[model samples]
Target: MKRLCKKRELISMDLTPLIDVVFLLLIFFIVASEFKKNETILNLSLPNSASKENIVEKKAIVIELSEKKLAYKTSEIDFVQLEQKLSLLQKDSQLTVKIDKEVKYKRVVKLLDILNKLQLSNLLLITKSQ
Candidate 1:
């Protein structure tokens, strides 16, 4: 007698579409994420230095000084306001100072004076890498 039924083949699912969808979602998330841009409010021509050290502190307070204005953590502030805000910080608190390359010497001196008076010496001066 002849066999009534033929052998059946196994069915398999294609994974190419699943992988493509996952990669597409990954690319979408990568493109959608926003990176933090430090001191984006001011157009600063930062002075360049040859040193390659990146000593950014996570908890440091940022002070940005441009030719026409000064900003503390992105908010425009005057010298008195700066002094007041800085005075509230601990002596050991880290401070990141970003001064424009075109800023006047007197302004830098003035900022140094305030820092000196406060005795907040944990300072990091941010400069562009050469």
Candidate 2:
């Protein structure tokens, strides 16, 4: 008498569901991510310049000068406070001055003077292309 042999089924994993889950997660993150814009909340009429080069630096210190008040980022700050803040920043940190066209010339000069005194080398002036 011969003994009958039993056939064993091969085990396999279906990866279609895994792939679908991964793709769904990717889509969710893409939709949830925020995109930064060049537009600022502060109303500013930027000066026009012939230069077209746009340089963006990491951890840039932005100082906005409007006709009425000076702002460090979004909060309004005084000149002395600005100086104190600048003094705390690293020497290599990039500084971007965004001055409104209607702002007084003396205000710009004062800010420049402070920057000059600090000896911050990475300085930039934000202007619109004409």
Candidate 3:
């Protein structure tokens, strides 16, 4: 009697389902994610200063002043409208002002006067750090 040997086959995994699930998750996140808008639209050069200390505040109202216009959260507004909007904010709410380097000093003084009237003492001036 002669003895016979049996041949063995290699096992492999099917990764098609795994790849499909990964692609579906990527698509879902891409559709549900929110992109941040560019906050600075005005072509104004910011002044630089050598300051190491920085303060970060949450939920502060941002006001941007350019040579041509004033902006609040990307919307161009006038002084009257800005005053009305600021009037609605809480007396202690923090305010951040981003004024262009070339903007006149009087405009800044005017804004400061408005803030003084509203008594918004928590103010932050945004400037570039050198």
> Which residue pairs in model 1 clash with each other?
none
- Score candidate 3 by TM-score against the native: 0.80
lDDT per residue, candidate 1, 15-37, as tens digits?
99999999999999999998877
Model 2 TM-score, all chains together: 0.70
Q: Alpha carbon lDDT of residue 86, candidate 3?
A: 92
Checking candidate 3 for backbone clashes, the offending pairs are none
TM agreement with the true structure for every prediction: 0.71, 0.70, 0.80
Q: Which should have the higher lDDT, number 2 or number 3?
A: 3
Query: How would you encode candidate 3's per-residue C-alpha lDDT over 1-130 as one tens digit per residue?
Result: 8989778888899999999999999999999998887776666688998877567585778889887799886788999999989999998898888999999999988889988998889888888887
**Where does candidate 1 have its weakest 10-residue lDDT segment?**
35-44
Clashes of 1: 0
- For model 2, what is the C-alpha lDDT against the true structure? 0.85
Q: Write the per-residue lDDT of candidate 2 for residues 1-130, one digit (tens) a residue.
A: 9999989999999999999999999999999998885435478999999987777775677888998788886678899999998898888888878899988989889988998898877888899887
Clashes (backbone N, CA, C under 3 Å), per candidate, total: 0, 0, 0
How does each model score on lDDT? Answer: 0.91, 0.85, 0.86
Name every residue pair that clashes in candidate 2: none
